[model samples]
Target: MTKIPTALLLTCDAQLVEIDLPFGHDCASSAERRAVLRAALRCDRFDVVALTRQWDMWIDDEGLYNHPVNPAATALAQRFGFTHQPYHGPVLLTGGPDAQGNTLPLLRHQVIGLFLTLQDL
Candidate 1:
């Protein structure tokens, strides 16, 4: 299965997860999705990668900082032990959309300016 070398922590919600850098597609079971997260973490170029649910309205309106499942997202952070702080202004959230207009259900934090921990990265 070629699982990722990095450690895996279960988020509070138990649905999502956060992986540390030096990350690879092996972190995720799905190749495509894993690639996306790996790329985002590696780039460290973007400020943040907002992940929305497929049917989230924000996809069309483009006005969601975090998704309803953000609690779950937070859980993911805690699970991975990724050190996190309050987000500053002018954050960008982007993702796919669904029938109701919801965006994809996942977001990745790039942490451009500051660094992060493996547990919280």
Candidate 2:
């Protein structure tokens, strides 16, 4: 059996929820993927948000790093005309892109690893 990565957990509208996904015999449809992204993003407030793996305070200290906004994030931003900004600092949450075009939940260590990879200098 193939071990699928865990789904990303998101707090939407104050509701902590996981992306709607199928398991075993079922696969998550594109509609489900859209719904998950729609709910996860806040266009009004987060039209353009920044993310980071680390902070150097001074720009010269280290080169800037940022996450590449994927299609999912871009679509959401476009729908609401929200700005899409990439960033690199510390991840307060645990998530990343999965094969299904949805964020997958990660452990603290996993998140740290991702951050390290993103901001590696």
All-Cα superposition RMSD per candidate: 14.1, 13.1
Query: Model 1, stretches more than 4 Å misplaced?
Result: 5-13, 16-35, 38-66, 75-121
Tell me the tens digit of each residue's lDDT in model 2 across 22-116. 32323555455334433444221122132322211101111122222243323322433445532222112334444553434444565455345
- What's the true lDDT of residue 65 in model 2? 28
Per candidate, the number of residue pairs that clash is: 23, 8
The lDDT for every candidate, in the order shown, is 0.30, 0.32
Number of colliding residue pairs in model 2: 8
Question: Candidate 1 versus the native: TM-score?
Answer: 0.21
Off by over 4 Å in 2: 1-28, 44-112, 115-121
RMSD in angstroms between candidate 1 and the native structure over all alpha carbons = 14.1
Choose the strongest candidate by TM-score. Answer: 2
